[model samples]
Target: MKIELLAPTSAALPTLVVAAGERASVRFLEFFASAIRNPHTRRAYARAAGDFLAWCAGAGASSITAVQPLHVASWVELQTQTHSAPTVKQRLAAIRHLFDWLVTGQIVPHNPAASVRGPSHTTNKGKTPVLDATEARQLLDSIDVSTPIGLRDRALIALMVFSFARIGAALAMRGEDVYVQQRRLWVRLREKGGKTHAMPCHHTLEAYLHAYLEGTGIADDPRGPLFRTVARGTGQLSDTPLPQANAYAMVRRRAFVAGIGTKIGNHTFRATGITAYLKNGGTLENAAAMANHASTRTTQLYDRRRDEISLDEVERILV
Candidate 1:
């Protein structure tokens, strides 16, 4: 019965929540279903909320309403011992937000996580590994473009490197997202927070995209996904959108074949492009705009120009 109610939300009602009553169970399910818009965030928050509630149940909390500040605080402290500060902080946020939703629904009298504090952390740089210009070029050139799959892979990588696009946004794109503007090729990305970002293609990226679209004949189905899975046993593109995990695996396989040693992921190309742009005299403000970052501070995290300086200075030690 609870599973039926939670089917749409994909979150199970915690033991404590189920014990609270049908109203609490329904409200608990609604919190995740209606309160969160992003599927990834919703999943993360649901996991956090479930883990915390299960902990409370084991700690002798009789019901959902029995959770207290001490329970929230203890769980947060335990998280810090096993998790990084940022991850702990995100879990704490999940607990706090879930309780807030429950309180608004009158399921809980107050939010137990309201007074809890998360660990503090700060960083100036992102940890996504980046490839140098030569390596980037080599990887792209190493791909054999005679096949449709090869053309798709090459175009996808070039899109991230040249447009500074997030993998989520790039994968969300439809065939119609690649369109002409002012006699130039342009790509549309639906970024986080529902922001739509459009960027004109670099000449190299333009050529790659043209080849992928025409070679695969995906251009005819403007409503279908731009990037698709290869049909099983057919060696042809399927209508299904390519999942992010598949994209990551494709990148790793491509890197291995190209003899590149860097442990890279989908995000590597975005940071690499930003660093390359900065090295080529692109301003931080302009990079922020092109990358659709709300602030230059966020953009600066991807700028790795100082890494070269640090390496050069380390050589001076002569150790």
Candidate 2:
């Protein structure tokens, strides 16, 4: 019962009629437009809400106002059968928060999801595939820096691994974000929640950055995007900023060429960097600070030092 956007002009701005009558959908639309600030969160919540409301409509609920705690519980229970615990919990949170927004806006009597409990989930480890120290070094050294694209690729990957930068923050940088502070290169990241995080570049990262910047000749264009798309037919970077999808594709290609076959994504470097740091006697608090995490618990997920111990123990069980 997924609702398809009636208007095709812009997929994101689709008119979704959630309630029974068209009139009750105003608050539903406004909830996403005004209440949600993060685009990723907004998109996810909208999908969850849309899916739930469509289900409710099929379940004979009259309108948004008629949605009850029973309906929320029923949907949540259904989700548990097909989705992972974390995903179920996230979807439930989306519903609960949306209803809360509607309640405060006077669109509904009360939140239907207020008492609903999501599935239980807890983990000390994250799922991001990380490279070992040797593998990480091999991957970095494998990149040939003969072309502008090659230089850019090596630098971008090094930045993430050395500085523990999130992909979004790394791509969002302007050329000016890389600057000389106290005669050493430093990077400024506009991280999640719009927090400005600044970290001194690792000496290796500094070398890669200098190579990319100087080789590209875009260093003087301080206001231009730090990472640019390779222009079609020119074998050089275009003025347009590199998109996240393109970055992912480049990473996959590089990994494949390097003959390393662990299914990795952008977050792989961040986890690899943190694990490397912690293995060298770095503290959890310092790792949290470097990774711009609000809590050490989140930082702990990236610490894969325990992974080595687990591997060593597994060798004892001879088949």
Question: Model 2, 258: alpha-carbon shift in Å?
Answer: 0.9
lDDT per residue for candidate 2 within 1-319, as digits (tens), equals 2222343222232233443344446556667767888888888887898788778878888777888999999999999999999999999999989888777877788998999989889999999999999988988899999999999999999999999999999999999999999999999999999999999999999999999999999798999999999999999999899999999999998999888999888999999999999999999999999999999999999999988999999999998
lDDT of 1 at 32: 73
lDDT of 1 by residue, 195-247 (tens): 99999999999999999999999999999999999999988999999999999
Candidate 2 ranges beyond 4 A from true positions: 1-23
Best candidate (score: lDDT): 1
Count of backbone collisions in candidate 1? 0
Question: Which candidate number maximizes TM-score?
Answer: 1
Clash statistics: count for each candidate: 0, 0
TM-scores for the candidates: 0.95, 0.94
